[model samples]
Target: MELFARSEKTRVVEEIGGVARLGELVRELGGRRVLLVTDPGIVAAGHVERGEAALRAAGLVVERFADVHENPTTADVARGLAVARDFGPDLLVGFGGGSPIDVAKGVNFRVSCGGEMSDYRGRATATASLLPLVAVPTTAGTGTEVQSFALIADAATHQKMACGDPSAAPKIALLDAELTLTLPPFVTACTGLDAIGHAVESAVTKPRTTVSAHYARAAFEVLAANFPRVVDVPTDLAARAGMLRGAALAGLAIEHSMLGAAHSLANPLTVRHALPHGQAVGTMLPYVVRFNATLEPATRQTYAALARSGGFADAHAPDEQATEALATVLIRFLRLAGLPVDLKPLGLDERALRALAGEAAEQWTAQFNPTPVDPSAFERLLNSAS
Candidate 1:
């Protein structure tokens, strides 16, 4: 086994009432002017107002930029950047789901680095310093707060851009499970599955380091045990807290190992159909798992072990049986969450499948899949998901 260099840095402060700490966090960061990035839904949920109050109480000048969309477009980032420039915020507060958090990262990069979104398309792309950022997740999914990357969509093409740099990582992450209680059932389901997809993809990626695998395995265990419980009882704060921690762990996993074809395939659905990122990825996860199972026996065994440890199968089960059991458990969970079990439900046709497959093949994550997945292979996976 080859040993790869590991660079991991995440400051995640989590609790049931972490939002209350926002005031002190801003003071610690010495931020007087702040920009809060979010969406209308988050504002309606009152998280934005709560965050604003915390900042203001801490003696910071707070500006609200709530125009972030479901799948954040480049224009959204540009608009937020314009606000940041106008406010000259000493700090940025990302206060919602992944879309807003991602947009905040992009805004920070653009405002400080002085470039278009396309200029920093790959890893470690920040050429200049960035303002300090704090992330507060209203949703339990996406874990964007713990990552050093941002996914911004192109305005004209709707293609999600994967931009990464150390500068994009938030200086602090505040995870308050209380905020997640207001999430609707469908949103809970989709985001939970997104966390599972992250763990699974991280486990089997070509760049899977020991550190990544550790985080992935822990994330998988947390999600596997708690996601169903949360779906069954949405008001369970303990279950919600578990899911939040799981999502954060998965985020840490992906930050190191990256993701795979599931994410690659999921991006196009958001681009074309406007599907939620979690729902799109959850729909493709089982197929990606089955595809990855065909790799080396050791790889398959590792995945199976992860599955069994996560309670997807009995510990005594054979690797093949365990793998199949894991896939079945995932599919069942998705169905119970009222998510689309097939592409047909999502209104995907053969032509769209081909287009998405071609698009998936070009994604940066596809290259990291343990198995060599080409456009044709992705097409078959799309059909299988359908």
Candidate 2:
């Protein structure tokens, strides 16, 4: 048997009113000058004010940088770097969805290490340790709070870059379901599906191990049970908590394992069409599940196991039958979320599929997909979706 080592170094605070405890965490991290990273949407939604009030009540000096936008890019990081440099903060607070948190991570790297975002594009590229950071997520997706990766896109090329290092992981993840209660129905659906995609893809990626599988399976179970309820009843706090924690578990899985072709396909759609990341990935997952199952017996069985865990398939069913069941469940979520399952609804046609395939082949996550995926393979997958 092969040997594997797993590490989860971040402290997690899971409770209903966890954000109110930020003062205690700030003092523990020994933070003096603090910078809160967020966006206009979160500011308007009042989450940013609540977080700012918590830090202030802790008797800490606070500065707010609300310049971040969705799908943060090189320019956004540079803008954030300027603020961090001027403020000279010892601590950074990421207080929004994935975009703000990712920008916070990217800015930390540049402000501490002194380089462009692309300098640390791949894994472990940072030369020095980043500042102590805390994540206060307002959504239940991306799991960037727990993961050591910072996904920032290039401003010019619009290609998403994966910047990762051990130092990039948050020192603390503050999960408060109260912050997610205000999420609009569409946002809830998009982010929930993104979490589900992370769990589904991480389970069968090439780097998956025993530990990663444990997190992935647990995430799948929670998401399958609660994602629909939260989407249908936005005020369900219990269901919201389940989705939030499930996203974090799936994120931990990605930290240990990584993702697959669904993410690879989703990125190009986001870059080209400005589609939400969750919707893009969710649209492709059902097809990717079936695609990998046909070619990889191990992945087929893994999908089967996931189906059995969700109680949607018999434990003794054939790999193909189990995989089909899992795919059906994924489609059921997509449909319930009112997301399109095919490329045609997105205004793309058969003629455009080849271009999208070529772009997907260039994504870094594509290399980790269980079945070997070339542009030709992606062409077929896209066709299947159509």
Candidate with best TM-score? 2
Which regions of candidate 2 deviate over 4 angstroms? Answer: 1-7
TM-score: model 1 vs. ground truth: 0.94
- lDDT by residue (1-386, candidate 2, tens digit) is 11112347677788898888887788899997899999999999988888888888999999999999898999999999999989999999998999999999999999999978999988888899889999999999999999889989899987778998998999898989999998999999999999999999999999999989998999999999999899889998999999989998888889989999999999888877788899999999999999999999999999999999998899888878989999999999988988876877776776678889999999889999999999999999988887
> How many clashes in each candidate?
0, 0
Model 1 segments more than 4 A misplaced: 1-7, 346-349
lDDT (tens digit, per residue) of candidate 1 on 1-386 = 21112344557777787787798898898888899999999999888888888888887788999999987889999999888888888889999999999999999989989989988888899998888889998887787888988988789987777888987888888889999999999999989999999998899899998888888898899989999899999999999988998999899888879999999998888777888888888888888888889766766887798888987788899999999888888889888898777788776788888999999999888999888889999999999877
Each model's C-alpha lDDT? 0.87, 0.90
lDDT value, residue 362 of candidate 1: 92
Residue 138 in model 1: shift from native, Å? 1.2
